[model samples]
Target chain A: MRKFAALLYKDLLLLVRDKAGLLFLFAMPMVLVLVMTGIQDGAVENSSKKTVSVLILDKDRDEMGREIISELQRQDLFDVTLADSTQTASEVQQAVKEGSFLIGVYIPENISSMVRNEIESSLSEMLGLGSTPQTDTLSSLKVFIDPTVNNTFRTTMMCYLREASNHIEKKALLSTISETAQEFSPFPTDSMAPPPDLKPISIDEIAYSKDAFRTNINVTEHNVPAWTLFAIFFIVISLSGGIIKERQDGSFSRLMAMTCPYSTYLMSKIVVYECVCVLQFLLVMMMGKLLFPLVGLPVFSMHGAFALCLMIVFFCALAAIGIGLTLGTFASTHQQASVLGAVTVVVLSAVGGIWVPTFLMPPFLKAVSVLSPLNWGIEAFYNVILRDGGIRSVLPNCLLLLALTVACTAVSIVAKKKI
Target chain B: MATTILRIEKLRKTYPNGNKEVLTGLDLTIGQGEIYGFLGPNGAGKTTTVNILAGLLKQDSGNIEIFGKPVASDRKNTMRRVGFVPQSIAIYPELTAYENLSVFGSVYGISRPELTNRIGKLLDLFGLEKFRDKKAASFSGGMKRSLNLMVGILHNPDLLILDEPTVGIDVQSKVVILEYLKTLNSHGTTILYTSHDMEEAEHLCTRVGIIDGGKLVAADSPEALARRFPECHDLKSVYLELTGKELRTMED
Candidate 1:
């Protein structure tokens, strides 16, 4: 322990003295989070500010049609445009397909009257009256969505339509029940009776994460973890260079001639660099939390257990340091280590969903992404921050990262012996 | 009658890269308190032999005993009594002179107070006390070399192996280093030093070995070797007489 402490202290001194290394570790990540979050937020804002143009064909032309139109308009994401009475369903579909509108809704003719008749018949049957015969009529709502719209937007649009349908049905059912009770009243009831305010089934759309107010992940939440991981893994460049420097300068040879085990030297380097990675993460996160809001971006809010998030970050740091140690051990010179380390990190970031979301990647790249330790790190972060996942959810990724650390450390140890 | 500090018998090494045979059945031994100068031209296996003695490289086949125990059987314990100063300036450039010595000293399991004292004494002895707080990268070549040497001997090993310890240094630093080596030898520190400078070897070595083509051509006191080659005037002439005047600059 004493010898390890000495080695650790020496490495720390060297790291702090390297001004360029310190800057790369801390400053680079902060700037990346801020700039990337700003850019992504601007894109989000532009897209959201231009509301989706929705065309509605109300063949019902009654209470249900008006209620649906009013409800769709209440949503901030939609721009509801009522179609002319002469326009057909095919015309609305063609308009949406032509990109004139993002979505088109068609309400069947006499749909509100059918709903009122169905509720009244059900109520009369419940009161021991005979059922009334009804004519066959179209009862389904038809919606046409632009194929270019992504699944998330399509799903959100469908959810809002369903909500509107539920609201109108509930309103019609209560009014029918109130009217029926008045006709069959045994006591004299005043005309000032308040309408039933009962809501049998209300559906509220919310983000699945810990924060109920968060309808969806914002730019800050997405970019902060992604860029921070990229910067953390980038510690390889400086760390591998340091290792090669020690070998070329004969410090490694001198140390080998002593009574200490080789593991001591390797451990000292890993411990120091891992600490630097953690510090980099904290610095970037703090910038996202405090500095981002000042720059007109949303604050980076963590939605998972803080302790679990830290554990994932800690494992990620270990994996990054392990790669650094392996690169330094195998590389003959500083240039070789730096170049190979940088390229490896870039490739990892590329396939690991750093530049794009994993789901957005093609099939082959998405399959390959699982092999990257950075991918594991980002997935784990998403699980905690975006999914509000607990230990049970992130345990697999954490274990995989830990396994990578062990494997990489093993390689380094074997290579150092040969050196 | 002196205690044998190091012994090697039938030592052999063949690098697998180009199947190059660097050492072939070489035998040598050094005794306590003897300044044994190992001299060779380029590619004569001087660095390889010293690296093996320092536990930096594994021999293909050899029997090496230091302090009367087999080095292979107890390498860590054997290394505890040995110190090696490599040809390159090996100190951490980003670290202070004191820090370099302290780290290396701690590896030998020295107490903090004792290591500090030893580091201070070494710094004063090497005329590096004033630069103790300065990073090795900022030091002159000679000062860096001095700090490198200090790190090697921070634990006061029983045997010190140095490879070109004074190369690329000023005359003043060279004189001080030579004087210090002599002082260390007088205090019973066995020294195995390798150098190409015949004059420095002739002045400092109690006995010197001249090797060429992976074999020791001659081994004796400088005066005795000169007497043996009566036509030669000094150790350099004796070396030339035994190894020839051909240029030896090829890769070993």
Candidate 2:
């Protein structure tokens, strides 16, 4: 035990004395986290959530006009501001043209009456109680938008208005039916109501909105753990490079000359790196889960996130050490160790969904990503950080990481024997 | 009658490729407190012999005993009592002189205070007291060599095996190292030294063995070996007379 502690302490002291290495170890990952998060958030903010502000002019000042604006605001996708009582349709359009809002709309008087009249006449003709209804020439609603506005936005605004008009027609029909039944019976009969098209496609939209919200992934949750683990796993390069230097320069012989079992030396290497890796894990997590809120990202509850992170990071360190030791043992030169170490970590990080989400990857690459250990690690992080998963949710990822550690460490032992 | 410190009988080895044999039925012995010199032409297998004796290599067929412990049966016990100075500098360059000594001493299982004491003593003995805290990376070649030798013997082993410890160094540094070896031998330490410097070997060795083509061609006092060859002026000529005038180069 004394021998083991001495060797471990010596290596750690040597690493700490290297100012450049220490700087990279502590500063590089923090900087990468901030940069990557900023970049990802930039893409997310730009590509999604096209929030539009609308200036609404309600000339009718009726229930139908209020319902349209209320429904738009209820979706939480638009900022709906009512026009002043004195503002005209031209004033609303001018406000939109002057860059006050992305969209402008006017609801003139008698537009609600026109929709109600159309529904009643159509229902009466369908029932053969009157002649075929004449289609009205009066426009019901007029919208003005910036010419630079995209067609998608135009289509979205048209859909909202169409739905709002349909809802008002249904409400007017229901009220007329109730009045007719009040004259004859106690309850409104189904025959008194208008056609089936007046009914909504869905009576309840709350459930849909709840699910639609999940479509937007929080970039911070995904970026924090993915890049943090990516940086931590890169210990393979530094660890392997250090060991290969000692081996090439014949300093390793000094340890062998002392009758110090090579196994003990290998263990000390693992211990020292594990210590460093765990410390790195804590430092990175502090900035990720703790300080993420400063940048408008929600600070996920630390309750279960800590254990999930610790478990995965521990095995990740072990697996990283295993890779480093195996490569250091097999490589005949310092360059071989460094190049192989760097390439392996880089390739693993790419396929493991660190840089790009697997869900967004092409089919074949996504299928092959499962073979990467980093894939399992990043997946485990995603489950806890983004998916609101618990300990049981990440069991498979944790077990895979541990299995990789065992297999890699075993192979490294075999390789070390040749040395 | 000096007690025997190393005894080898019928030791043999061959390369894995089987193109050439490294050691063939070689035999030798060294007594306690003896400064034994090992001499050979190129490819004479002096290094192979030293490697096997130091327990770094396993001999295919042999019985090797160091201080009555069979090296093949008890590798750790024998190696713990042996100190080796490889031809290359093996000390950690990134470590301070004191740190290097402490690392080796601790692994040898020396207690903390004793290891500390030994580091101080060895640093002074090598006249590196002022540079104790300095890293070995910036040290001169001779200072590194001296520190390299110090790390080997820091555990105070009974038998020290030095393989060309003075290959590249200044004359004054070489003299300091040689005088220190003489001092160590006088204090009841057995030394096994291999070098290409014939004059140094002729004066320093109590007994010298010359090997050629994996065979022990000569083993006797330097004066005795020189006397046998009347045509030679010294051990240098005697070495040439015994080994041959032909170059012993192997094809790459």
Candidate 3:
């Protein structure tokens, strides 16, 4: 055990001196979390483009056009304004050109007559009563815009036109069918009166609740914290270069010549790597708490967050040590071990959702994620932070991580013997 | 019957590729505190012999007894009493000389106080006390070699096995190392050294064994080998007379 302590001390000393490994394992991941979280918040905020002002020119005085105007006003995306009849193509163009409004819609004077004609034509075609429908009612609703408005305005206009066309079609169908049917003499006048204005569908605008809040929280909040946990594991794999260095240098054989057993040396490595990983985990979590809120995540409870983080760090440390042992056994040189170590970590992290979200992945990829420790770690973080889950909720992931640690450690020991 | 520090009998090793025989029916013995030199041309099986004795490589057929205990029966205990300084620089270059010594000493199960004392003594002996805090990587070839040797001896094993210890060092470094080995010998440590330097073997070894074609050609005190070859005055002449001057190179 004393011998192992010495070995562990030496490994820690080497790790302190190797700046490249330190940066790759600890600093780089922290930086990545900061950058990724910032970008994610930016994307979410950009997607929610609040209120857009719309100019409306209603040439038709019919009730259908009036109904369409009222409907446009109801949607929160648009702030609709009616334009006078005197407003010409140039005047409307100037208003859009001056950037007073984001979009403009001009309803033609013959719109109601056009709807009537379209319904008749469609009925004639379906009944084989006349030739095919003549007018393109759907095509005429297209708005002419100042091309400078670009695709955003074009897309919004297309959406608006589509909604209007649907309403027109429904209203026309009701009018046409009722004209052909008998008058509604069976129902009493009081009974025929329209039902009291049904309340508008109440949409809860609350982006998050205390219980379901985590799902609505931006990726930066969950991903950065989770990545910090992953970074600690990565550090373990990276620092394993010390073992390979000792082996290549013949220092390990020389050590074997002494009273120390292979078990002591191997155990020391596991201990030192676990310590480093845990340290990294704590540092990054602290940094996340301090820095990530600027990217839009709410302040999280530190006690539960850290407790979950510690469990992940422990698991990662074991995995790292196991990987180091495996590499030490198989690698002929420090360079070989370092390269393989780096490659394994990168590939594992990619599959584990460190680089990408598992939810966005295909079903097969999600299933494949089960094989990676990162998936369990992220799941654990989600439960803790999003679900407000306590120890019981995270217990399953913690157990799996512990199992991985044991399995990896056993394989590492067996591999060490072979070496 | 003075307790034999090392004993090998009927040791045979064959490479799987090309059916090459590296060692065939080799037998030898060394008593305590003896500086035994194993001399051979390249590929005469000097390294293979050392590797087998060190338990780093398993021999196909052999019986090795160290301190009256069968090597295979209790390999770990046998290894503990032996220190091997390999041909390569086994110390981590990134570590300081003192740090390397401490790690190696710890691996040997030395107590902290003992390790601290051993490191200081080794640094002073190797004339590396001033560079104790400097990383081994920045040291010259000779300094690195000296530190490497120091790391091997930090545990103070009873039997020290050095494989080409002076292979790639300057004359000054080699002299310091050889002088240190002599000091260790005077303190009753048994040493088995392998080297191609005939003069070094003549000066340092109490007895020298010349091997050729994986077989022992001569085994006796350096003076005895020289006296037996009437035409030979120096150890080099004795070596050439026995193993021939032809270069032996193997195709891997």
Where is the poorest 10-residue window by lDDT in model 2 chain A?
Answer: A204-213
Query: Candidate 1: which stretches are off by over 4 Å?
Result: A51-207, B250-252
Off by over 4 Å in 3: A50-182, A186-192, A195-215, A293-303, A333-335, B14-19, B250-252
Question: A153-239 in candidate 2: lDDT tens per residue?
Answer: 778889999889878877878765555445566555654554334435556333211124555456766776777787778887778
> Mind listing the fnat for each candidate?
0.85, 0.56, 0.75
TM-scores, chain B, all models: 0.97, 0.96, 0.97
- Clash count (model 2, backbone only): 0
Docking class of 1: medium
TM-scores of all candidate predictions against the true structure: 0.81, 0.78, 0.83
For candidate 2, the TM-score is: 0.78
Question: Please, what are the lDDT tens digits per residue for candidate 3 over residues A89-131?
Answer: 4566667778887677777677777787788677667656566
DockQ of each: 0.63, 0.47, 0.60
lDDT of 1 by residue, A204-272 (tens): 887787777778778887888889889989988888899889888888888888856788888998889
Q: Candidate 1, clashing residue pairs?
A: none
Q: Native contacts retained by model 2, as a fraction?
A: 0.56
Judging by DockQ, tell me the better candidate of 1 and 2. Answer: 1
Q: What tens digits encode model 1's per-residue C-alpha lDDT throughout B22-141?
A: 888778888888898999889888898999888888888989999999998989888888889999999898888988888888877899999999998999999989999988899998
Q: Can you tell me which runs of candidate 2 are displaced by over 4 Å?
A: A49-191, A196-217, A289-304, A387-390, B15-18, B244-252
